[model samples]
Target: MCRLIGAVSRHRAPVADLLGDDLDPFIRLACEHKDGWGLAFRQEDGTIGILRGIDRADDSDRLQHALKHQLTDMAVLHIRMASPNLAVTVNNTHPFGDARAAFAHNGEIRPVAALEKLIDPDLLATAAGTTDSERYYLAVRERMNRGVTPGDAITLTAQAITQSSDLVVSLNAMMLTPTGLYAYAQHDPHSEVIGRRGPAYFGLSYRQEEDLVVVASEGWPQPAGRWAALPDGEVAEFPALHP
Candidate 1:
């Protein structure tokens, strides 16, 4: 489980500018979700750039610097609360990807072995971490390799896992691609964790302004009227500016 924030803008801007007043509170979420942090953005050259640290976002000087210095028309941030048995390591941190795209997941799929079985062998060999989140990402990437759009890739992977795995708590995640940002939200409303964390635990919401669109996890004080919930079991795409 984790918290995520992502944005697509018409002009290059720092992520802090996109979050506005919500930045601090979002960072403070690391106080509880204190395992690792990561951020990914499109570089000037059009390649995806990522920075990750196995430290709480609230306390990481590196994160602080990036929040101020890094600027992009598209970006995604993740603060991880390591799932049971997952170690706190850089490789396990999020916003994982290659030059084409970046991804961060906010839920877990049980018996990760089952999900692993669905991934192509070559893709599986590239995994740098054991977290189900990584496998979940590779699953989507596998489909993308076959020419599927990011949103469809996510939906197909989610459907496949739910059909073959046990106890899929959620498949909520944000994928930042070369052209746009995609958010996927799918969770078991009746699950025990949702009951404990409240119905909004795995929920995702977005706010679209004239120049930018922002999507984020539920945790802090985003005004209900201003932020629209991204519908469950579906994917939402926000286009970003490109060279």
Candidate 2:
């Protein structure tokens, strides 16, 4: 479980601007989602990179520094609320990828032993840390190695994991490619799971304004009914609004 934000705009924009407020008074979320944080995107020179730290986003100078331009093209900002037993370290950060793609998740698929069994062996080999999020990315990459698109790969990989595991599954996730930002929101919709404050905060939402399309985890500050919830169990792409 975590908080995530992804955005794509025709013109360059800073991450802070897209995330709304830095020290948002929403219970100081940036300070609370303190497991780790990361920013991943295709740089202006066409190389993708990640700037991250295993520190609270509110305290991470790196997060603020990179966020100044994380949304430069297509990018994602992830503030982790790591699952139980997962270490709080840099290797376990989100938006896992290389120069061509990046992937992040806001949900959990438990029993790493079982999850790893279903994942591709090669992916497991390359894994630098132990996290369902990273393994999910590897599984998707395995599907992509067969020639399907990244979005399609994610869908297939997610389906495989769901069928293989009996544990509760929440696949709210996002992937950044040169073409667009593809996100998936799937979980138990009617569960009594929610903050003591309101509805489930793990859902994904987005809003498009003129030339920019923004996606974020629920519970972030947004005007009433301004954000659109992503369809459950579906994969959708948010291309640059001006593209």
Candidate 3:
């Protein structure tokens, strides 16, 4: 119920190139994914600059401003379609971060309140907002805090959550680390997404060009031979762009 975009490369380019200009494609997709919009990019100082709005992407002034002006070698963008029970508020937006990483998720876990109980209570105590997606990120970060690599943390967390929850649909997500971009895509064999959304829309793909690597949800238009799908049930890691 969300769409995510991530870009990282050796050279910082105008955000518009990865997203779009006046013909904003992500905003157009927001017609269906309209809940809130958020953008997080790594700054030159090694900190994050976050711009988010509790409005549809197509309607978000901040997104418009970012596309026009911002530049970064690393960025994450999300246009949300809130799960039925979650509120459409700023705190519940996608793209949450910690000291070392930023994360955004595209799927859901059933009975989120129950799922929260499975995450580390100390970290869960620090959750700024209530949503399955944020809880999932906290769970993974807790593992990373204990020295597990971010890529493995996501895989292990996804495997554990899937074992614990029934009727779970998908677990497609992306994470931004200082040196790499990480992603995983896993789903229930019986979930309705198989018939309703199909593989083309559910698969995560990226192009590691000479200068930058870009990953995004499937519905966006991609150039011929420029994209490759991340294998299901496996984590794909794209190393930082070359200087």
Candidate 4:
């Protein structure tokens, strides 16, 4: 399994500040996920700035330091634990996207080869690494181009994965669009977690005072308000700006 985090805010804040103490522990946990790590942050011009490395999180102090100091309105972070047959490299890290959209995912794809036929040529061309997460992102982009909304695109992606394999999956993903943040949690048949029968845990918290919204694979450092757990098979959308 892997850990993922994404944030959308009304104001730009240091990525480090948003991550806080959670950053170190999360990075440490990511060490077990040792395949690679990556982060993508939005630029004021609406483009994305991404950094990735094949190094373990513990050795990514430089990368983390840069993100901690840089501030952006939207960001996506991922630490991957490679699945069998997948290559480990910088290009394979999460938070994959094009000029407009970005996404991060945690899970494994079964019979990953089958989905190749379902992806778009353009997306296939953008494949920088051989990882299911990147293919998943491309698949979602293709579906979106076909008029599927972001939420529907996620469900469609899940359905497509089901077609390929029966592996228990734990697809905890985050998508960043121009207008908002969208997140999803779906169980993969091949997940390696212990006691996998319970509900998949994912949470989102918004601090109005800080004008920030945080989406994490697991909740920590309990905050004051009731933390809302995203419903299974449901997508949660947070508007970029408050109405």
Best by lDDT: 1
Q: What is the C-alpha lDDT of each candidate?
A: 0.90, 0.76, 0.80, 0.72
Predicted candidate 2 versus true structure: per-residue lDDT over 1-243, tens digit per residue: 788788777776665665555225432576667788888876776666787788887887777677664556677878888887999888899989888778999877766676688667766899988898898888887777779988788888788888887664578899887677899988755444443324657678788777778787776566647788888888989865433
lDDT of 3 by residue, 184-215 (tens): 88776667776777756667877775676777
Better of 1 and 4 by TM-score: 1
Better of 2 and 3 by lDDT: 3
Ranking under lDDT, best-scoring first? 1, 3, 2, 4
**What value of lDDT does candidate 4 attain over all alpha carbons?**
0.72
Candidate 2: residue 55 Cα off by (Å)? 0.9
TM-score of each: 0.98, 0.89, 0.91, 0.84
Clashes in each model (backbone N, CA, C under 3 Å)? 0, 0, 0, 10
Q: Which tens-of-lDDT digit does each residue in 121-179 have in candidate 1?
A: 99999999888999999999999999998989999999999999898898999998888
Give the runs in model 4 whose Cα sits over 4 Å from its true position: 188-210, 219-226
Candidate 2 worst ten-residue window by lDDT: 19-28
Q: Once all C-alphas are superposed, what RMSD does model 1 give against the true structure?
A: 1.0
Name every residue pair that clashes in candidate 2: none
Query: What tens digits encode model 4's per-residue C-alpha lDDT throughout 159-204?
Result: 7777665563666688887767788877743345534533343333
Error of 3 at 228 (Å): 1.3
